[model samples]
Target: MESDMTAALIRPVAIKLDEVTKARVKRLAEARHRTSHWLMREAITQYVDREEKREAFRQDTLRAWDEYRSTGLHVRADEADAWLAELEQGKDIEPPPCHK
Candidate 1:
């Protein structure tokens, strides 16, 4: 099934690993009963997943800050903390509405 995918769908990369690192990769791959290529793919997948989440968080924070500056409406840290505490206590409380 994987081979059925078009070449355009998968880009190949060339990596030059040091001799030690290459041996380590082989050993680790063998321990997991997987090929070094599979391990490399997994590593890249995880890196992309983590970095994408961080990028999204940064964009969201910037957007929220912009909105707050434009509207002058915000929630106090104490209010937010109290709401969070209620959540920790398993209370079904709604979040406080934001206001100027």
Candidate 2:
């Protein structure tokens, strides 16, 4: 199921890299015992993962701002105190849910 999910999200695109970059990538792949294509895919995946994380963070910040705006008038001092306390206590904070 996880494999299918990953496969569904990936699409192939052909690109032309500079000759020097292509040679560097080839050498890197050889050192890592992987094909050039595999190395390229790994690089692309890392780039995409970084971009997705940034986008998710931006969305979460926007959502938090929106929530704050809507509830500012009704927010309780105790609630704010409790949230700060939780943060100071070093409790684990869950990451935002992943979106397709």
- For each candidate, how many residue pairs have backbone atoms clashing (under 3 Å)? 0, 0
lDDT of 1 by residue, 1-100 (tens): 6666775598788999999999999999999999999998898899999999999999999999999999999888999999999999999999998979
lDDT (Cα, 0-100) at 56 in candidate 1: 100
What does candidate 2's lDDT look like per residue over 6-86, in tens digits?
A: 999988889999999999999999999999999998898899999999999999999978876776644466766676777
**Model 2: residue 62 alpha-carbon error in angstroms:** 0.4
**Residue 83, model 2: Cα distance from true site in angstroms:** 6.6
What TM-score goes with each of the models?
0.85, 0.60
TM-score of 2: 0.60
| lDDT at residue 83 of model 1 (Cα atoms) | 100
